[model samples]
Target chain A: MHTRTLAELGDALAAGEMSSEELTRHFLTRIEALDPRLNAFITVTGEAALEAARAADRERAAGRAGPLTGLPIAHKDIFCTDGFRTSCGSRMLDNFISPYDATVVRRLKSAGMVMLGKTNMDEFAMGSSNETSFYGPVRNPWDLDKVPGGSSGGSAAAVAARLTPAATGTDTGGSIRQPAALTGTTGLKPTYGRVSRYGMIAFASSLDQAGTITASACDAALLLEAMAGHDPRDSTSVDAPVERYADGLDRSLEGFRVGVVEEFFDEGLYPASAAAIETALDVLRSLGASVKRVSLPNLALSVPAYYVVAPAECSSNLSRFDGIRFGYRAENPRDLADLYKRSRGEGFGAEVKRRIMTGTYVLSAGYYDAYYLKAQRVRQLIAEDFRAAFAEVDLIAGPTAPTPAFDIGAKTDDPVTMYLNDIYTIGVNLAGLPGVSVPCGFADDLPVGLQLIANHFEEGRLLNVAHMFQQETEWHLRMPGGEFA
Target chain B: MALTRRQVESIANLARLQINEDEIPAYVRNLSRIIDFVDQLEGAGTEHVHPMAHPLNMSQPLRADEVTESDDRARFQANAAAVEAGLYLVPKVIE
Candidate 1:
């Protein structure tokens, strides 16, 4: 039961083979036994999960079950849940019990999914490795010594370990896809504004997007179908029709034009991982996809531009954490200025503070045009490059990460070196295009992910392409045990 | 491209973050390297290009000017550090 994909689990529940309560208990038991090994979960709402499962069983008995009814899933600690504490992996929000549910949480609950718990993440979703998490780093299930890439590391680890069938994650510059790559999970970051951002804690307002980490593209399609749509609460949420993504999964990939980015296979990628990506492209070719060599000339500038733009936006967004209203407050403040300073300095982790200061510097009086404005223009060039490339191809493909997961403490000393981990994935976010990282093969006994990017609002076409690849390959089904041994 | 220590201190103040004296050196070092790294953006030819603030180039959406949410002061105040008489308390400003 624990090994089954979300789609398989839903089918079992629909066939009356097992009750939702029974299925929820099965996962809860696995979480109790395995979660300590990975530190994937920050909070486990077992009692609430049982209660929700019972309700789902009652709904199924009443003949009103949805496709997601009774399925258990975890949420990255970023989303606000009414009763559960939404920590956002920060000491500042460690004690915050939100007054309402994030739109993503509300939608999934209405679809009858059971909440297993809130998974851990990098503090304020800032770091590439999970080491920056306040709840401690989530170790890769495949190898205990390596990181499960972050800031969506907890969700990726949880899904990879089969602690939960699926988990929700937010991507801002590869948070979802990078971690998914390391953990051998299927991760999707939909086009910006595709999923409403209401009640999900803000990281980088323009770049942030809610997505999923699941066992297969099929499960991602199911979740995306339920979660995608406009909500008036989030002004940026696109007022576009949400497609029935699952219905498009079985579409043939014949005549599909795949453009492999020439820059993605540059010196940054490891030889083994590059080989894995090449082999995966062959599988796509065998399925009748015509491979074309393409180049997004401005893609290399993504990291530097993202560092400027994301921090600039985050510094503004995170200003709400000032001591007076909510979040952490310094004790015995001598004045208002001290209250604000000490509260933020003490509350935020080092990486978060570094970003806040970086933003403050770039957007400062003398440097705004030199740094912030310059970065924004480069971002435009990168987006324009993607537009040009997509006109000639139906999809773009590349490696998700440079290599497999690395040691936890390897890149923490140098922030720039750490930021480059998302070299292949960040360009998609800069352009607001949807992208997914699906397991392709293993390198050094650890998993490598093949990233697929689509033009804006092409999530259905992207998922269909991925589902067809998954049909021809069993890479997504392999678990993380032999490597552990 | 490296930021001076004084600049780092001023930036922290602008961001309203209290950095202890001992932590200043590390901040100066890390912040300098990051700034140097991002300075590569200056090389790109952005002279005639329009800057993109939004990803989709969409303008902010406006809504009808009506009271959309009911008063939930008590519920919201529960998360505040100190609240009295239905108002958030802060350090006194004027003498």
Candidate 2:
């Protein structure tokens, strides 16, 4: 029961083999027993989950339940759940409970998916590793000493450990896919604006996207189907018709053209990671994909460009957190300036402060053009490179990160080393393309991820390709041992 | 392309972030390295490229203005360090 895919879970629910209440209890017990070790959840809404699960069971009894009707799914702490604390792993929002649901949460509730709990993340979804999370870091279920990639580390760790069959995550720059890569879970970041962003705690709005970390690509397809859609509430939400993601899982990849970015396989990448990616390419080749070496020369500039643009946008978005608002306020302030400074100083973690400072500096009067404007222009060049490359290929493939999961404190002090982890992924966000990290092979007893990237609004195709690959491999089926088994 | 320690201090002061003096060297080194890398963009030919801030160019639609939801200010402000009469109380701004 614990190892069944989401589709199987749905079938079981429909067949009365297990009630949603029973499934929810099973997961709740697993979370209670395991979360203390993983620190995956900041707030576990057990009572709400049980209540929602019971409602799903009632809906199933009435024969009105949707495909994911009774399946339990957790949300990253970034999404606002009306009655639950939606802290984006920041002390600034540690006590902030939203009054309304984020669009993704609302859609999931409407679909009757059980709300398991809120997973932990980096402060404001800013860091590459989960170490910057104010609640503490999430331990990779595969190896406790290794980090689960972040800011969606908690979501990836939870799903990998079988705390829940699937979990929601958000990526700005490589939050979802990178963490999913490290934890050996399937996570997808839909094209920009595909999922509405209203009520998602804003962090680099242009780059931020809601996605899922699940055990299989099929499970991700189901979760994506439930989550993707336009909402008038989010000004940037693309008004496009939602597709049946799970319906095309068994689609043949006979004519698929997989582009292997030559720049991605350059000197900086880990040798083991490079080998695993080559093996994944072979799998695609076996599935009849015509693989070719493509070059996106501008990708080399992505990390530097992303740092400027993301922080600049983040600096603007996070300005709303001043003590005058609903979040945390400073104590014993003699004046407004002191209040503002102390509140932000005390509330934000070290990494958050560092980013805020960097963002503020770059966007300041004198440096805006040299940094922010140049980054945006470079971003356009990178996007154009993808556009040109996609004209010759159907999809792009590479290693999600340069290496497998590193030790917890390995890159904590070195911000550049941490930023480099997103080198392969930042380009996807920069180009506004959809990308996924599927477990392909292991390096040094840790999981390595094969990254699949598709053109904008090509999520269905990407999922189909991933599902086809997953169908022939059992990597996604492997799980860590614990009470879950 | 390295930033001087004085420049780092000035930037930190301008941003209102209190960075310890000892940490300035590392921050300067790292930030300068990144800045130098991004500086490579200056050589790219972007003269004719209109800076694309967003992928899609569609304009946002407007709806009739109305309050769709509300939060209890008193309850919401309950977690704040200072508050008074359904408003967040900040330190006195007027001298």
Q: Evaluated with TM-score, which candidate comes out highest?
A: 1
Which is the leading candidate under DockQ? 1
Full-model lDDT, candidate 1: 0.94
Report the C-alpha lDDT of model 1 over A343-449, residue by residue, as the tens digit: 99999999999999999899999899899989989999999999999999999999999989999899999999999999998999999999999999999999999
| RMSD to native, candidate 2 | 1.9
Evaluate model 2: give its TM-score.
0.96
Which residue segments of model 2 deviate by more than 4 Å?
A: A482-485, B4-30, B70-75
Error of 2 at A347 (Å): 0.7
User: Which regions of candidate 1 are displaced past 4 Å?
Assistant: A482-485
List DockQ, one per candidate, in order: 0.90, 0.51
- Candidate 2 residue-wise lDDT, A1-485, digit = tens: 77888888989998899999999999999899988989999999999999999999999889898998989999999999987888899988887878779999999899999988999998899887799998999999998999999999999999999899899999888899999999889999999999999989998888899999998999988988888988889988988999999998899999899999999988888898889889989999999999999999988788888888887787778778777767777778878777776777678887776677678878888888888888888889899999999999999999999989999999987687788889899999988899999999988888999999999999999999999999888888888765545
Question: Worst lDDT window (10 residues) for model 2 chain B?
Answer: B12-21
RMSD per model, one decimal: 1.1, 1.9
